[model samples]
Target: MMSSPPAASPQALLRRLLSGVARVFVVPVSADGQLLLHRHESDRHCYWTYPTMQRGTMRTDPATVARRLLREELGAESGVLRLVHVLPAARTHARSAVYAASLDLPAAEILAAREATGTSRRALQGLAVTAETLVALDVRPLAINDLMTTGGIPARTLLALPDLADPASTVNQPG
Candidate 1:
C-alpha cells in the first residue's frame, strides 16, 4: 500500500487547524440580580461555565450549541433565553457567548421538568448567588459589554433581555 502523506510538523499542523477552535461560555442572570453559576467539586469551590460541550471541532454551530447548553445545564430551553454577551476567553483564540435567563420559573417547576425529561438534575447544584456574593466567592464577573467588543457575538444580532413575564397575568410574579 502507498504510504500516507508525510507527517506535518507541529507548527504547520497548528497553523492549518488554528482557524477551527473556539470556546463558548453562557452566563445566566436573574432579575433579582442573582447570577447562575456552576459549582464543580474540584479545588475551586465555584466558577462559571455553561455546560459540558465539546471544546474543539465539535463546536461548529453556535446557536445549536447555545440551545443545547441551556437545556443540559439550566434545564431550560431557548424559547425564553436572553442573549447578553459574547466575550473572548483571555488570550486564547476561543470565544464565549454569555446569556442571562431569569429565575422567574419556580424551583419546583425546574425540578419537575428535569425529572420528567430524565435529565441530570445535579448539574446546577451550586447555590444561585447574587452579584454581591459572586465577588466574595472569587468568581470572575462576566459583563454584557465585554462580549460585544471581542468579535465573539454575532454582529447583526443585538443581544436583548426578554420580558419573561407570565402571559396569564399582566403583572410579573414569581413563578
Candidate 2:
C-alpha cells in the first residue's frame, strides 16, 4: 500500500474555508425602488449585474463589503443599505448577500462619480430605464445562471411555462 500524503493542517483548512466562500452584491436603487444594473461581460454572454465585490479581511462584515463596492465602483459614499436577499451559490459563485442601496443622487451624479474614480469604462445605467426594460430587451446575464442553466433558457422571452409551486415568486423570475 502506498503511504498517504500529509493531511492539510487546521490553519490551511480554516484559511480555505474562510476564503472564497463569501461575496457581496450591491444593488443601487432609486428612491422609487428601481434596480440599477450595470453592463457585465462574461465569456458566456453579456448581462447586467449589480456591483459585486468579494468579502475581504472583514469577513463577517458584509456591510463593509457593500460600502467598499459602492465607493470603488461608483465612487460614491455609502448610501442607506438594507439586506434584500441571500443567494446561495448560483453556478460557480460562492454564497452572496444582496443589499439594496437607496441612493438620493441623480443618475448624472452617479455617472460623474464613476468617471471621477477613473472607472468610466464601466457602463452604468441611467435611472430612466428600469429592470423591466433590461429584461424586456432580451438580456439575462450570468447572475441568474442557476435558473437558466437548469432550464437551458437564456432569456425571459423563451421562458413560457409558469411554475405553480410558488406563483408569487415567479412574478419576476426569468428562470
Candidate 2 Cα misplacement greater than 4 A, ranges: 1-21, 31-34, 41-46, 56-60, 119-121, 130-132, 137-175
Judged by whole-model lDDT over C-alpha atoms, candidate 2 comes out at 0.57
Q: What clash pairs does model 1 have?
A: 86-147
Compute the lDDT of residue 103 as modeled in candidate 2: 71
lDDT for 137 in candidate 1 is: 53
* Window of ten residues with lowest summed lDDT in model 2: 157-166
lDDT (Cα, tens digit) per residue for candidate 2, span 1-175: 9999999875565444334548887767553334456776778776676678878556476767788788777776644565544566766567776565667676677776677778646787753343344445533334543332333322332132232222343434322
Candidate 1 similarity to native, TM-score: 0.51
lDDT score for residue 15 of model 1: 36
lDDT of 1 by residue, 1-175 (tens): 9989999775564334333436555555443333445555567564544443444567365445666776786677543454344455565335554544445554456556776886775555334443344434544433432332333221212233332222132323232
For all predicted structures, in order, the TM-scores are 0.51, 0.57
